[model samples]
Target: MNKLLVITVLVALLALSAESFRVPRQAAAEEEEGTLARITDTVKSYYEQSVNTASNYLESIKGMKLEEKAKNLFEETTKAVSTYTGILQDQLYHIFYPQN
Candidate 1:
Protein backbone atom coordinates (compact mmCIF):
# COMPACT_ATOMS: atom_id res chain seq x y z
CA MET A 1 0.00 0.00 0.00
CA ASN A 2 2.84 2.43 0.77
CA LYS A 3 4.51 1.61 -2.54
CA LEU A 4 1.28 2.24 -4.42
CA LEU A 5 0.89 5.61 -2.71
CA VAL A 6 4.48 6.55 -3.59
CA ILE A 7 3.92 5.60 -7.21
CA THR A 8 0.71 7.62 -7.32
CA VAL A 9 2.45 10.71 -5.97
CA LEU A 10 5.27 10.36 -8.47
CA VAL A 11 2.80 10.02 -11.33
CA ALA A 12 0.96 13.11 -10.17
CA LEU A 13 4.21 15.10 -9.98
CA LEU A 14 5.17 14.03 -13.48
CA ALA A 15 1.78 15.03 -14.81
CA LEU A 16 1.99 18.43 -13.12
CA SER A 17 5.49 19.07 -14.46
CA ALA A 18 4.40 18.20 -17.95
CA GLU A 19 1.54 20.69 -17.69
CA SER A 20 3.87 23.40 -16.36
CA PHE A 21 6.18 23.01 -19.38
CA ARG A 22 3.24 23.45 -21.74
CA VAL A 23 2.35 26.80 -20.15
CA PRO A 24 5.71 28.30 -21.06
CA ARG A 25 5.43 26.98 -24.62
CA GLN A 26 1.98 28.52 -24.91
CA ALA A 27 3.30 31.84 -23.59
CA ALA A 28 6.17 31.80 -26.05
CA ALA A 29 3.77 31.17 -28.92
CA GLU A 30 1.67 34.14 -27.80
CA GLU A 31 4.74 36.37 -27.53
CA GLU A 32 5.84 35.41 -31.02
CA GLU A 33 2.40 36.24 -32.38
CA GLY A 34 2.51 39.63 -30.67
CA THR A 35 5.89 40.38 -32.18
CA LEU A 36 4.70 39.42 -35.63
CA ALA A 37 1.65 41.66 -35.27
CA ARG A 38 3.80 44.64 -34.29
CA ILE A 39 6.14 44.08 -37.23
CA THR A 40 3.21 43.85 -39.65
CA ASP A 41 1.75 47.07 -38.28
CA THR A 42 5.05 48.89 -38.67
CA VAL A 43 5.48 47.76 -42.27
CA LYS A 44 1.89 48.75 -43.12
CA SER A 45 2.41 52.18 -41.56
CA TYR A 46 5.60 52.85 -43.55
CA TYR A 47 3.90 51.70 -46.75
CA GLU A 48 1.02 54.10 -46.13
CA GLN A 49 3.37 56.99 -45.36
CA SER A 50 5.41 56.31 -48.50
CA VAL A 51 2.27 56.29 -50.63
CA ASN A 52 1.16 59.56 -49.08
CA THR A 53 4.56 61.18 -49.71
CA ALA A 54 4.54 60.10 -53.35
CA SER A 55 1.00 61.35 -53.77
CA ASN A 56 1.90 64.74 -52.28
CA TYR A 57 5.00 65.03 -54.47
CA LEU A 58 3.01 64.19 -57.58
CA GLU A 59 0.29 66.68 -56.61
CA SER A 60 2.82 69.45 -56.10
CA ILE A 61 4.44 68.87 -59.50
CA LYS A 62 1.17 68.27 -61.33
CA GLY A 63 0.57 71.91 -62.26
CA MET A 64 4.13 72.77 -63.15
CA LYS A 65 4.61 73.82 -66.78
CA LEU A 66 6.97 71.65 -68.84
CA GLU A 67 8.73 74.69 -70.21
CA GLU A 68 9.29 76.09 -66.72
CA LYS A 69 10.60 72.72 -65.52
CA ALA A 70 12.96 72.48 -68.47
CA LYS A 71 14.19 76.02 -67.91
CA ASN A 72 14.84 75.40 -64.22
CA LEU A 73 16.68 72.14 -65.00
CA PHE A 74 18.80 73.89 -67.64
CA GLU A 75 19.71 76.75 -65.32
CA GLU A 76 20.74 74.35 -62.55
CA THR A 77 22.81 72.31 -64.99
CA THR A 78 24.56 75.40 -66.32
CA LYS A 79 25.45 76.62 -62.83
CA ALA A 80 26.83 73.21 -61.82
CA VAL A 81 28.91 72.95 -65.01
CA SER A 82 30.24 76.49 -64.59
CA THR A 83 31.26 75.87 -61.00
CA TYR A 84 32.97 72.57 -61.89
CA THR A 85 34.88 74.13 -64.78
CA GLY A 86 35.96 77.08 -62.67
CA ILE A 87 37.36 74.70 -60.02
CA LEU A 88 39.19 72.71 -62.69
CA GLN A 89 40.64 75.83 -64.26
CA ASP A 90 41.88 77.11 -60.91
CA GLN A 91 43.54 73.77 -60.15
CA LEU A 92 45.21 73.68 -63.56
CA TYR A 93 46.41 77.29 -63.23
CA HIS A 94 47.96 76.58 -59.83
CA ILE A 95 49.72 73.49 -61.21
CA PHE A 96 51.15 75.23 -64.31
CA TYR A 97 51.73 78.71 -62.85
CA PRO A 98 52.90 78.07 -59.32
CA GLN A 99 53.49 81.53 -57.78
CA ASN A 100 56.92 80.63 -56.44
Candidate 2:
Protein backbone atom coordinates (compact mmCIF):
# COMPACT_ATOMS: atom_id res chain seq x y z
CA MET A 1 0.00 0.00 0.00
CA ASN A 2 2.76 2.40 0.98
CA LYS A 3 4.75 1.54 -2.15
CA LEU A 4 1.70 2.14 -4.36
CA LEU A 5 1.02 5.47 -2.68
CA VAL A 6 4.64 6.57 -3.11
CA ILE A 7 4.67 5.54 -6.75
CA THR A 8 1.40 7.41 -7.43
CA VAL A 9 2.80 10.57 -5.85
CA LEU A 10 6.03 10.30 -7.80
CA VAL A 11 4.12 9.79 -11.04
CA ALA A 12 1.92 12.83 -10.36
CA LEU A 13 5.01 15.00 -9.72
CA LEU A 14 6.63 13.81 -12.91
CA ALA A 15 3.43 14.46 -14.84
CA LEU A 16 3.48 18.07 -13.63
CA SER A 17 7.15 18.50 -14.55
CA ALA A 18 6.09 18.44 -18.22
CA GLU A 19 4.53 21.90 -17.80
CA SER A 20 7.53 23.40 -15.99
CA PHE A 21 9.93 23.29 -18.94
CA ARG A 22 11.61 26.65 -19.44
CA VAL A 23 10.80 28.27 -22.77
CA PRO A 24 13.85 29.54 -24.62
CA ARG A 25 14.84 33.04 -23.51
CA GLN A 26 15.98 33.96 -27.00
CA ALA A 27 14.04 36.41 -29.18
CA ALA A 28 11.31 34.80 -31.26
CA ALA A 29 13.19 35.60 -34.49
CA GLU A 30 16.39 34.08 -33.05
CA GLU A 31 14.71 30.84 -31.97
CA GLU A 32 14.32 28.27 -34.71
CA GLU A 33 10.72 27.92 -35.91
CA GLY A 34 10.87 24.15 -35.42
CA THR A 35 11.98 24.55 -31.81
CA LEU A 36 9.20 27.05 -31.09
CA ALA A 37 6.63 24.81 -32.76
CA ARG A 38 7.87 21.82 -30.77
CA ILE A 39 7.57 23.66 -27.45
CA THR A 40 4.06 24.92 -28.26
CA ASP A 41 2.98 21.49 -29.44
CA THR A 42 4.34 19.83 -26.32
CA VAL A 43 2.40 22.24 -24.09
CA LYS A 44 -0.80 21.67 -26.08
CA SER A 45 -0.33 17.92 -25.88
CA TYR A 46 0.11 18.09 -22.11
CA TYR A 47 -3.01 20.23 -21.81
CA GLU A 48 -5.00 17.67 -23.79
CA GLN A 49 -3.54 14.85 -21.72
CA SER A 50 -4.60 16.54 -18.46
CA VAL A 51 -8.10 17.17 -19.79
CA ASN A 52 -8.38 13.57 -20.96
CA THR A 53 -7.16 12.35 -17.61
CA ALA A 54 -9.92 14.27 -15.84
CA SER A 55 -12.55 13.18 -18.37
CA ASN A 56 -11.51 9.54 -18.01
CA TYR A 57 -11.64 9.77 -14.23
CA LEU A 58 -15.13 11.27 -14.37
CA GLU A 59 -16.24 8.56 -16.78
CA SER A 60 -14.90 5.89 -14.44
CA ILE A 61 -16.84 7.37 -11.53
CA LYS A 62 -19.97 7.65 -13.62
CA GLY A 63 -19.61 4.04 -14.72
CA MET A 64 -19.17 2.70 -11.20
CA LYS A 65 -22.00 0.55 -9.81
CA LEU A 66 -22.34 -0.46 -6.17
CA GLU A 67 -25.90 0.09 -5.10
CA GLU A 68 -25.22 -0.34 -1.37
CA LYS A 69 -22.17 1.89 -1.45
CA ALA A 70 -24.00 4.44 -3.59
CA LYS A 71 -26.92 4.48 -1.17
CA ASN A 72 -24.60 5.30 1.70
CA LEU A 73 -22.91 8.00 -0.34
CA PHE A 74 -26.26 9.54 -1.26
CA GLU A 75 -27.34 9.60 2.36
CA GLU A 76 -24.12 11.28 3.39
CA THR A 77 -24.38 13.80 0.61
CA THR A 78 -27.97 14.62 1.59
CA LYS A 79 -26.92 15.21 5.19
CA ALA A 80 -24.09 17.47 4.04
CA VAL A 81 -26.42 19.52 1.82
CA SER A 82 -28.98 19.78 4.61
CA THR A 83 -26.36 20.98 7.07
CA TYR A 84 -25.11 23.63 4.68
CA THR A 85 -28.64 24.75 3.90
CA GLY A 86 -29.41 25.13 7.61
CA ILE A 87 -26.25 27.18 8.07
CA LEU A 88 -27.20 29.44 5.22
CA GLN A 89 -30.70 29.91 6.61
CA ASP A 90 -29.29 30.82 10.01
CA GLN A 91 -26.99 33.39 8.41
CA LEU A 92 -29.86 34.89 6.47
CA TYR A 93 -32.02 35.03 9.58
CA HIS A 94 -29.24 36.76 11.48
CA ILE A 95 -28.87 39.26 8.67
CA PHE A 96 -32.57 40.15 8.83
CA TYR A 97 -32.72 40.02 12.62
CA PRO A 98 -29.47 41.64 13.63
CA GLN A 99 -30.70 42.10 17.23
CA ASN A 100 -31.17 38.36 17.55
Candidate 3:
Protein backbone atom coordinates (compact mmCIF):
# COMPACT_ATOMS: atom_id res chain seq x y z
CA MET A 1 0.00 0.00 0.00
CA ASN A 2 2.85 2.43 0.75
CA LYS A 3 4.52 1.66 -2.61
CA LEU A 4 1.24 2.34 -4.41
CA LEU A 5 0.91 5.67 -2.69
CA VAL A 6 4.41 6.66 -3.70
CA ILE A 7 3.74 5.74 -7.33
CA THR A 8 0.51 7.71 -7.37
CA VAL A 9 2.24 10.82 -6.03
CA LEU A 10 4.97 10.52 -8.64
CA VAL A 11 2.43 10.20 -11.42
CA ALA A 12 0.50 13.23 -10.18
CA LEU A 13 3.65 15.38 -9.99
CA LEU A 14 4.61 14.38 -13.57
CA ALA A 15 1.14 15.28 -14.83
CA LEU A 16 1.23 18.68 -13.15
CA SER A 17 4.63 19.49 -14.67
CA ALA A 18 3.46 18.40 -18.12
CA GLU A 19 0.38 20.60 -17.82
CA SER A 20 2.55 23.59 -16.92
CA PHE A 21 4.56 23.14 -20.08
CA ARG A 22 1.50 22.62 -22.29
CA VAL A 23 -0.29 25.75 -21.05
CA PRO A 24 2.42 28.19 -22.18
CA ARG A 25 2.73 26.54 -25.61
CA GLN A 26 -1.01 26.82 -26.13
CA ALA A 27 -0.98 30.45 -25.02
CA ALA A 28 1.91 31.29 -27.37
CA ALA A 29 0.11 29.66 -30.30
CA GLU A 30 -3.03 31.66 -29.55
CA GLU A 31 -1.06 34.91 -29.35
CA GLU A 32 0.64 34.21 -32.69
CA GLU A 33 -2.70 33.56 -34.31
CA GLY A 34 -4.11 36.81 -32.96
CA THR A 35 -1.14 38.78 -34.31
CA LEU A 36 -1.53 37.18 -37.75
CA ALA A 37 -5.24 37.99 -37.79
CA ARG A 38 -4.57 41.64 -36.97
CA ILE A 39 -2.00 41.93 -39.76
CA THR A 40 -4.40 40.36 -42.25
CA ASP A 41 -7.19 42.75 -41.22
CA THR A 42 -4.94 45.81 -41.60
CA VAL A 43 -3.78 44.71 -45.06
CA LYS A 44 -7.34 44.06 -46.18
CA SER A 45 -8.45 47.49 -44.97
CA TYR A 46 -5.63 49.26 -46.85
CA TYR A 47 -6.41 47.31 -50.04
CA GLU A 48 -10.07 48.32 -49.82
CA GLN A 49 -9.16 51.97 -49.22
CA SER A 50 -6.80 51.96 -52.22
CA VAL A 51 -9.51 50.50 -54.45
CA ASN A 52 -12.01 53.13 -53.30
CA THR A 53 -9.53 55.97 -53.93
CA ALA A 54 -8.80 54.71 -57.44
CA SER A 55 -12.53 54.38 -58.18
CA ASN A 56 -13.18 57.92 -56.98
CA TYR A 57 -10.32 59.34 -59.08
CA LEU A 58 -11.58 57.56 -62.20
CA GLU A 59 -15.11 58.81 -61.59
CA SER A 60 -13.90 62.38 -61.17
CA ILE A 61 -12.06 62.31 -64.53
CA LYS A 62 -14.63 60.29 -66.44
CA GLY A 63 -16.31 63.29 -68.12
CA MET A 64 -13.18 65.26 -69.01
CA LYS A 65 -12.01 65.74 -72.64
CA LEU A 66 -8.77 63.91 -73.21
CA GLU A 67 -7.77 66.15 -76.13
CA GLU A 68 -8.20 69.33 -74.11
CA LYS A 69 -6.30 67.82 -71.20
CA ALA A 70 -3.46 66.86 -73.48
CA LYS A 71 -3.38 70.35 -75.00
CA ASN A 72 -3.26 72.05 -71.61
CA LEU A 73 -0.54 69.71 -70.38
CA PHE A 74 1.53 70.42 -73.48
CA GLU A 75 1.15 74.19 -73.06
CA GLU A 76 2.24 74.03 -69.41
CA THR A 77 5.26 71.85 -70.27
CA THR A 78 6.33 74.26 -73.09
CA LYS A 79 6.15 77.30 -70.78
CA ALA A 80 8.22 75.52 -68.10
CA VAL A 81 10.85 74.50 -70.62
CA SER A 82 11.06 78.01 -72.06
CA THR A 83 11.54 79.51 -68.62
CA TYR A 84 14.28 76.99 -67.78
CA THR A 85 16.07 77.68 -71.05
CA GLY A 86 16.02 81.46 -70.48
CA ILE A 87 17.51 81.05 -67.00
CA LEU A 88 20.23 78.77 -68.33
CA GLN A 89 21.10 81.28 -71.11
CA ASP A 90 21.41 84.11 -68.60
CA GLN A 91 23.66 82.03 -66.31
CA LEU A 92 25.92 81.04 -69.24
CA TYR A 93 26.21 84.66 -70.45
CA HIS A 94 27.17 85.85 -66.94
CA ILE A 95 29.68 83.02 -66.50
CA PHE A 96 31.39 83.84 -69.86
CA TYR A 97 31.29 87.66 -69.43
CA PRO A 98 31.22 88.69 -65.79
CA GLN A 99 29.86 92.20 -65.09
CA ASN A 100 32.07 94.89 -63.42
Candidate 4:
Protein backbone atom coordinates (compact mmCIF):
# COMPACT_ATOMS: atom_id res chain seq x y z
CA MET A 1 0.00 0.00 0.00
CA ASN A 2 2.85 2.45 0.74
CA LYS A 3 4.57 1.60 -2.53
CA LEU A 4 1.29 2.14 -4.38
CA LEU A 5 0.92 5.54 -2.72
CA VAL A 6 4.47 6.52 -3.74
CA ILE A 7 3.87 5.43 -7.30
CA THR A 8 0.63 7.39 -7.44
CA VAL A 9 2.35 10.54 -6.14
CA LEU A 10 5.18 10.18 -8.61
CA VAL A 11 2.76 9.71 -11.49
CA ALA A 12 0.78 12.74 -10.40
CA LEU A 13 3.93 14.87 -10.18
CA LEU A 14 5.06 13.83 -13.65
CA ALA A 15 1.64 14.59 -15.12
CA LEU A 16 1.68 18.02 -13.53
CA SER A 17 5.14 18.76 -14.88
CA ALA A 18 4.11 17.65 -18.36
CA GLU A 19 1.07 19.91 -18.17
CA SER A 20 3.17 22.87 -17.03
CA PHE A 21 5.48 22.54 -20.00
CA ARG A 22 2.58 22.21 -22.42
CA VAL A 23 0.87 25.30 -21.03
CA PRO A 24 3.88 27.47 -21.75
CA ARG A 25 4.15 26.14 -25.29
CA GLN A 26 0.48 26.89 -25.91
CA ALA A 27 0.87 30.35 -24.40
CA ALA A 28 3.92 31.07 -26.54
CA ALA A 29 2.04 30.10 -29.69
CA GLU A 30 -0.84 32.38 -28.72
CA GLU A 31 1.53 35.25 -28.00
CA GLU A 32 3.26 34.81 -31.32
CA GLU A 33 -0.09 34.79 -33.14
CA GLY A 34 -1.14 37.97 -31.40
CA THR A 35 2.12 39.67 -32.31
CA LEU A 36 1.65 38.72 -35.95
CA ALA A 37 -1.90 40.06 -35.92
CA ARG A 38 -0.74 43.37 -34.52
CA ILE A 39 1.94 43.66 -37.13
CA THR A 40 -0.55 42.96 -39.89
CA ASP A 41 -2.88 45.61 -38.54
CA THR A 42 -0.08 48.17 -38.42
CA VAL A 43 0.95 47.50 -41.98
CA LYS A 44 -2.66 47.75 -43.14
CA SER A 45 -3.04 51.08 -41.40
CA TYR A 46 0.13 52.44 -42.98
CA TYR A 47 -1.07 51.55 -46.47
CA GLU A 48 -4.53 53.00 -45.81
CA GLN A 49 -3.03 56.27 -44.64
CA SER A 50 -0.79 56.44 -47.68
CA VAL A 51 -3.74 55.80 -49.98
CA ASN A 52 -5.90 58.40 -48.26
CA THR A 53 -3.18 61.02 -48.47
CA ALA A 54 -2.69 60.43 -52.19
CA SER A 55 -6.45 60.51 -52.81
CA ASN A 56 -6.84 63.79 -50.93
CA TYR A 57 -4.04 65.36 -52.90
CA LEU A 58 -5.60 64.24 -56.17
CA GLU A 59 -8.99 65.60 -55.13
CA SER A 60 -7.45 68.94 -54.22
CA ILE A 61 -5.88 69.18 -57.67
CA LYS A 62 -9.18 68.63 -59.44
CA GLY A 63 -10.47 72.16 -58.66
CA MET A 64 -7.56 74.27 -59.93
CA LYS A 65 -8.20 77.29 -62.30
CA LEU A 66 -4.82 78.88 -63.06
CA GLU A 67 -2.28 76.95 -65.15
CA GLU A 68 0.60 78.00 -62.89
CA LYS A 69 -1.27 76.80 -59.80
CA ALA A 70 -2.00 73.49 -61.51
CA LYS A 71 1.64 73.11 -62.44
CA ASN A 72 2.67 73.73 -58.85
CA LEU A 73 0.19 71.18 -57.61
CA PHE A 74 1.53 68.65 -60.08
CA GLU A 75 5.09 69.25 -58.92
CA GLU A 76 4.05 68.92 -55.28
CA THR A 77 2.16 65.73 -55.97
CA THR A 78 5.15 64.25 -57.78
CA LYS A 79 7.42 65.05 -54.84
CA ALA A 80 4.96 63.55 -52.37
CA VAL A 81 4.61 60.37 -54.40
CA SER A 82 8.38 60.02 -54.72
CA THR A 83 8.85 60.43 -51.01
CA TYR A 84 6.16 57.91 -50.12
CA THR A 85 7.55 55.42 -52.66
CA GLY A 86 11.02 55.73 -51.20
CA ILE A 87 9.71 55.13 -47.69
CA LEU A 88 7.70 52.09 -48.74
CA GLN A 89 10.65 50.64 -50.60
CA ASP A 90 12.87 51.07 -47.60
CA GLN A 91 10.32 49.44 -45.34
CA LEU A 92 9.96 46.46 -47.65
CA TYR A 93 13.70 46.08 -47.94
CA HIS A 94 14.13 46.10 -44.19
CA ILE A 95 11.36 43.54 -43.76
CA PHE A 96 13.06 41.21 -46.23
CA TYR A 97 16.53 41.68 -44.73
CA PRO A 98 16.10 41.89 -40.99
CA GLN A 99 19.45 41.61 -39.21
CA ASN A 100 18.06 40.50 -35.88
Candidate 5:
Protein backbone atom coordinates (compact mmCIF):
# COMPACT_ATOMS: atom_id res chain seq x y z
CA MET A 1 0.00 0.00 0.00
CA ASN A 2 2.85 2.41 0.81
CA LYS A 3 4.56 1.60 -2.50
CA LEU A 4 1.35 2.23 -4.41
CA LEU A 5 0.88 5.57 -2.67
CA VAL A 6 4.44 6.63 -3.49
CA ILE A 7 3.96 5.72 -7.12
CA THR A 8 0.71 7.66 -7.32
CA VAL A 9 2.27 10.71 -5.77
CA LEU A 10 5.19 10.52 -8.18
CA VAL A 11 2.87 10.23 -11.12
CA ALA A 12 0.82 13.19 -9.92
CA LEU A 13 3.95 15.28 -9.46
CA LEU A 14 5.17 14.40 -12.94
CA ALA A 15 1.82 15.37 -14.40
CA LEU A 16 1.88 18.70 -12.62
CA SER A 17 5.39 19.44 -13.81
CA ALA A 18 4.43 18.68 -17.37
CA GLU A 19 1.44 21.00 -17.13
CA SER A 20 3.56 23.76 -15.63
CA PHE A 21 5.99 23.66 -18.55
CA ARG A 22 3.23 24.62 -20.97
CA VAL A 23 2.66 28.04 -19.45
CA PRO A 24 6.13 29.32 -20.22
CA ARG A 25 5.95 27.89 -23.72
CA GLN A 26 2.66 29.67 -24.30
CA ALA A 27 4.00 32.93 -22.90
CA ALA A 28 7.04 32.77 -25.10
CA ALA A 29 4.87 32.20 -28.12
CA GLU A 30 2.70 35.17 -27.22
CA GLU A 31 5.74 37.37 -26.76
CA GLU A 32 7.08 36.35 -30.14
CA GLU A 33 3.73 37.15 -31.76
CA GLY A 34 3.67 40.56 -30.15
CA THR A 35 7.12 41.36 -31.38
CA LEU A 36 6.23 40.28 -34.88
CA ALA A 37 3.10 42.43 -34.82
CA ARG A 38 5.08 45.49 -33.80
CA ILE A 39 7.61 44.90 -36.53
CA THR A 40 4.84 44.56 -39.11
CA ASP A 41 3.21 47.78 -37.95
CA THR A 42 6.49 49.68 -38.11
CA VAL A 43 7.22 48.49 -41.63
CA LYS A 44 3.70 49.38 -42.72
CA SER A 45 4.06 52.86 -41.28
CA TYR A 46 7.35 53.40 -43.06
CA TYR A 47 5.78 52.45 -46.36
CA GLU A 48 2.77 54.68 -45.78
CA GLN A 49 4.94 57.66 -44.88
CA SER A 50 7.11 57.15 -47.92
CA VAL A 51 4.03 56.97 -50.15
CA ASN A 52 2.48 60.09 -48.59
CA THR A 53 5.68 62.09 -48.98
CA ALA A 54 6.02 61.08 -52.63
CA SER A 55 2.42 62.01 -53.39
CA ASN A 56 2.66 65.35 -51.64
CA TYR A 57 5.89 66.20 -53.37
CA LEU A 58 4.44 65.38 -56.78
CA GLU A 59 1.31 67.40 -56.09
CA SER A 60 3.33 70.45 -55.06
CA ILE A 61 5.72 70.21 -57.97
CA LYS A 62 3.23 71.90 -60.33
CA GLY A 63 3.81 75.28 -58.73
CA MET A 64 7.59 75.23 -59.03
CA LYS A 65 9.82 76.33 -61.95
CA LEU A 66 10.08 73.67 -64.65
CA GLU A 67 13.73 72.72 -64.12
CA GLU A 68 13.47 72.82 -60.36
CA LYS A 69 10.22 70.83 -60.43
CA ALA A 70 11.75 68.13 -62.60
CA LYS A 71 14.77 67.87 -60.32
CA ASN A 72 12.63 67.68 -57.20
CA LEU A 73 10.38 65.03 -58.68
CA PHE A 74 13.33 62.95 -59.79
CA GLU A 75 14.96 63.14 -56.37
CA GLU A 76 11.78 62.35 -54.49
CA THR A 77 10.84 59.43 -56.74
CA THR A 78 14.32 57.96 -56.54
CA LYS A 79 14.41 58.20 -52.76
CA ALA A 80 10.99 56.61 -52.36
CA VAL A 81 11.75 53.80 -54.78
CA SER A 82 15.04 53.05 -53.10
CA THR A 83 13.49 52.95 -49.64
CA TYR A 84 10.71 50.57 -50.69
CA THR A 85 13.06 48.41 -52.71
CA GLY A 86 15.37 48.03 -49.75
CA ILE A 87 12.46 46.89 -47.60
CA LEU A 88 11.41 44.39 -50.25
CA GLN A 89 14.91 43.04 -50.58
CA ASP A 90 15.21 42.58 -46.86
CA GLN A 91 11.92 40.67 -46.79
CA LEU A 92 13.06 38.48 -49.65
CA TYR A 93 16.34 37.79 -47.96
CA HIS A 94 14.64 36.78 -44.75
CA ILE A 95 12.18 34.55 -46.62
CA PHE A 96 14.96 32.83 -48.49
CA TYR A 97 17.16 32.40 -45.43
CA PRO A 98 14.96 32.50 -42.40
CA GLN A 99 16.66 32.90 -39.04
CA ASN A 100 16.32 30.00 -36.67
Candidate 6:
Protein backbone atom coordinates (compact mmCIF):
# COMPACT_ATOMS: atom_id res chain seq x y z
CA MET A 1 0.00 0.00 0.00
CA ASN A 2 2.80 2.46 0.88
CA LYS A 3 4.67 1.77 -2.40
CA LEU A 4 1.55 2.38 -4.41
CA LEU A 5 0.96 5.77 -2.76
CA VAL A 6 4.54 6.80 -3.37
CA ILE A 7 4.30 5.98 -7.10
CA THR A 8 1.13 7.99 -7.49
CA VAL A 9 2.64 11.09 -5.85
CA LEU A 10 5.80 10.88 -7.93
CA VAL A 11 3.82 10.67 -11.16
CA ALA A 12 1.79 13.76 -10.20
CA LEU A 13 4.93 15.77 -9.40
CA LEU A 14 6.56 14.85 -12.69
CA ALA A 15 3.51 16.03 -14.66
CA LEU A 16 3.45 19.39 -12.87
CA SER A 17 7.16 20.10 -13.27
CA ALA A 18 7.32 19.21 -17.00
CA GLU A 19 5.28 22.26 -18.12
CA SER A 20 7.42 24.83 -16.27
CA PHE A 21 10.60 24.22 -18.28
CA ARG A 22 9.01 24.47 -21.77
CA VAL A 23 10.62 27.10 -24.07
CA PRO A 24 8.29 29.60 -25.77
CA ARG A 25 8.15 29.29 -29.56
CA GLN A 26 9.07 32.94 -30.14
CA ALA A 27 12.22 32.70 -28.00
CA ALA A 28 13.33 29.53 -29.75
CA ALA A 29 12.87 31.18 -33.16
CA GLU A 30 14.90 34.22 -32.10
CA GLU A 31 17.76 32.03 -30.89
CA GLU A 32 17.81 30.13 -34.17
CA GLU A 33 17.95 33.40 -36.16
CA GLY A 34 20.87 34.69 -34.10
CA THR A 35 22.84 31.46 -34.57
CA LEU A 36 22.27 31.53 -38.35
CA ALA A 37 23.44 35.13 -38.65
CA ARG A 38 26.61 34.43 -36.66
CA ILE A 39 27.48 31.41 -38.83
CA THR A 40 26.96 33.39 -42.05
CA ASP A 41 29.14 36.25 -40.84
CA THR A 42 31.93 33.84 -39.83
CA VAL A 43 31.94 32.13 -43.23
CA LYS A 44 31.95 35.45 -45.09
CA SER A 45 34.91 36.71 -43.01
CA TYR A 46 36.97 33.61 -43.83
CA TYR A 47 36.32 33.99 -47.57
CA GLU A 48 37.28 37.66 -47.59
CA GLN A 49 40.48 36.98 -45.67
CA SER A 50 41.51 34.25 -48.09
CA VAL A 51 40.89 36.51 -51.10
CA ASN A 52 42.87 39.36 -49.59
CA THR A 53 45.84 37.11 -48.79
CA ALA A 54 45.96 35.75 -52.35
CA SER A 55 45.79 39.24 -53.83
CA ASN A 56 48.64 40.44 -51.62
CA TYR A 57 50.78 37.44 -52.56
CA LEU A 58 50.26 38.05 -56.28
CA GLU A 59 51.05 41.72 -55.95
CA SER A 60 54.35 40.99 -54.17
CA ILE A 61 55.36 38.49 -56.81
CA LYS A 62 54.53 40.97 -59.58
CA GLY A 63 56.71 43.59 -57.90
CA MET A 64 59.86 41.55 -58.62
CA LYS A 65 61.41 43.26 -61.69
CA LEU A 66 62.57 41.01 -64.54
CA GLU A 67 65.96 42.70 -64.72
CA GLU A 68 66.73 41.92 -61.11
CA LYS A 69 65.74 38.28 -61.53
CA ALA A 70 67.98 37.84 -64.56
CA LYS A 71 70.95 39.47 -62.82
CA ASN A 72 70.61 37.14 -59.82
CA LEU A 73 70.34 34.09 -62.07
CA PHE A 74 73.46 35.03 -64.13
CA GLU A 75 75.59 35.62 -61.04
CA GLU A 76 74.69 32.24 -59.50
CA THR A 77 75.41 30.39 -62.77
CA THR A 78 78.82 32.03 -63.19
CA LYS A 79 79.85 31.01 -59.67
CA ALA A 80 78.87 27.36 -60.27
CA VAL A 81 80.77 27.19 -63.61
CA SER A 82 83.94 28.67 -62.13
CA THR A 83 83.99 26.09 -59.33
CA TYR A 84 83.54 23.21 -61.79
CA THR A 85 86.32 24.44 -64.09
CA GLY A 86 88.76 24.72 -61.18
CA ILE A 87 88.09 21.09 -60.14
CA LEU A 88 88.67 19.78 -63.71
CA GLN A 89 91.91 21.69 -64.07
CA ASP A 90 93.30 20.25 -60.82
CA GLN A 91 92.42 16.71 -61.84
CA LEU A 92 94.09 17.05 -65.27
CA TYR A 93 97.28 18.51 -63.80
CA HIS A 94 97.57 15.68 -61.27
CA ILE A 95 97.17 12.97 -63.93
CA PHE A 96 99.86 14.47 -66.24
CA TYR A 97 102.38 15.41 -63.58
CA PRO A 98 102.15 12.29 -61.35
CA GLN A 99 103.72 14.07 -58.35
CA ASN A 100 105.71 11.65 -56.05
List, residue by residue over 1-100, the lDDT tens digit for candidate 6. 8546655755654454454466755555445444445555565566567769999988888797767999999999999999999999999999999999
- Candidate 3 lDDT over 36-78, as tens digits, reads 4555556556656776998988877876777789999999999
Ten-residue segment with the worst summed lDDT in candidate 2? 31-40
lDDT of 5 by residue, 1-100 (tens): 8546655755554454343334453355444444445555565566567769988998777656778878999999999999999999999999999999
Q: Against the true structure, what is each candidate's TM-score?
A: 0.36, 0.35, 0.37, 0.34, 0.36, 0.40
Top TM-score model: 6
Residue 34, model 1: lDDT of 47
Error of 5 at 58 (Å): 23
Q: Arrange candidates, best lDDT first.
A: 2, 6, 3, 1, 5, 4
Better of 1 and 4 by TM-score: 1
Q: Which clashing pairs does model 4 show?
A: none
lDDT of 5: 0.69
Candidate 1 lDDT over 12-79, as tens digits, reads: 54454343334453355444444445555565566567769989988878766777989999999999
Q: Which stretches of candidate 6 lie over 4 Å from their true place?
A: 1-33, 66-71, 74-76, 79-87, 90-100
Candidate 1 off by > 4 Å? 1-64
| Tens-digit lDDT string for candidate 4 (1-100) | 8546655755554454343334453355444444445555565566567769989988777755467887999999999999999999999999999978
Cα displacement (angstroms), candidate 1, residue 2, comes to: 99
Runs off by more than 4 Å, candidate 3:
1-63
Lowest summed lDDT over 10 consecutive residues: which window, candidate 5? Answer: 17-26
The clash count for each model shown is: 0, 0, 0, 0, 0, 0
**Better model by lDDT: candidate 4 vs candidate 6:** 6
lDDT of 4 at 48: 69
- Give the number of the best model, judged by lDDT: 2
Instruction: Give the total clashing residue pairs for model 4.
Output: 0
